[model samples]
Target chain A: SQQGEEDPQALSIQEGENATMNCSYKTSINNLQWYRQNSGRGLVHLILIRSNEREKHSGRLRVTLDTSKKSSSLLITASRAADTASYFCATEHDTSGSRLTFGEGTQLTVNP
Target chain B: DAGITQSPRYKITETGRQVTLMCHQTWSHSYMFWYRQDLGHGLRLIYYSAAADITDKGEVPDGYVVSRSKTENFPLTLESATRSQTSVYFCASSETGNTIYFGEGSWLTVV
Candidate 1:
């Protein structure tokens, strides 16, 4: 079974707009990571926020984690046409040995 | 520099035939993983290895076999291919407690 489920299976927005995607997980985790996958390509690591950290930022990407809610959110500000891709949230369970369990993912389209 | 590479970028094989996908990394990362991506299923892990000679199953491990004889290489094999196994397969390597680096992926079709 997948450990996490991402909300808003798909999203579309105009360029320069903001896009947010949420993910909910079933169990506790040591850390959560976000990845981007362009069509017909493999996934690329975006960012990782440890369980102890509430938020993290990387350029236009912002990530927030709420341990109590067992959920996290990825925010992309000033989205561009190149930002169109599938975003996934992966959870690293404390018990697992660095094996990340991924969610279904959210497909985001940035219209130019 | 080749960070990670998967062989036979694309493959097409008949059902019931055995097929193998190769993955090689130059970083010598301690952990290696194999995942299959389907339309609605996202990326489901098939197997992972922490180091050479240590292998473990992931979320979707049925009909798949993985071996890590060397830290730089991990290969996934399908003993008997089935139509349902057609998908894009990816290989990744990572250091403990760090980000993972994925290969371009190998597209396989079981006809």
Candidate 2:
């Protein structure tokens, strides 16, 4: 079963606009990471927010984790056309072994 | 240097034939993973290995087999390829449990 579920199945916005995607999980997690996948390509790691941390940033990507609500969000500021891709959230549980459960993902299109 | 590489890049095989997808990483990451991407299913984990000689099944592990004989190599094999197994397969590796690096992916088509 999928531990994470991303909201807003798809989104379309202008190149300069911002795109925000949300993810919700069911159980406790050690960390939540976001990944971007271009069409017909593999996933690229974006940012990871640990359970103890509230927010983290990498370049124009911002990730926030709220353990209390079991939810996390990824925000891409001033989105570019190249940033158009599918984004997914993966949850790493605090278990003995490391196994990541991923969400369905959100497809974002940055229109020029 | 290739961080991680997967081959044959693209493959086409007949149903009931066995096919193996190979993944190799240069970082010697302790953990490796195999995932399949479908139209609506997103990325589903098929199998993962913590280290050499250790492997475990993931959510969609059925119909798939994996082995991590070495820290840098993890291979996924479909015992009997089926049309449902036709999808893009991605392999990922991580030094630890937190961050993962992925390969370019292998496109497999079972006819």
Which structure among the candidates has the greatest DockQ? 1
lDDT tens digits, residue span A31-112, model 1: 9999999988889999999999999999999999999999999999999999999999999996545889999899999999
Lowest summed lDDT across 10 adjacent residues in model 2 chain A is found at A93-102
Candidate 2 clashes between residue pairs 3 or more apart in a chain or in different chains? none
User: Residue by residue across B1-111, what tens digits does model 1's lDDT show?
Assistant: 969999989999999999999999999899999999987667888999989999999888999999999999999999999999999999999988899899999999999
- Per-residue lDDT value at B82 in model 2: 97
- Give the Cα error of residue B82 in candidate 1, in Å: 0.7
| Candidate 2 per-residue C-alpha lDDT over B1-111 given as tens digits, one digit per residue, 9 for 90 to 100 | 969999989999999999999999999889999989888657888999989999998879989999888898999999999999999999999866568899999999999
lDDT (0-100) at residue A42 of candidate 1? 88
- Residue A110 error for model 2, in Å? 0.7
Off by over 4 Å in 2: none
Evaluated with TM-score, which candidate comes out highest? 1
- Model 2 clashes, total count: 0
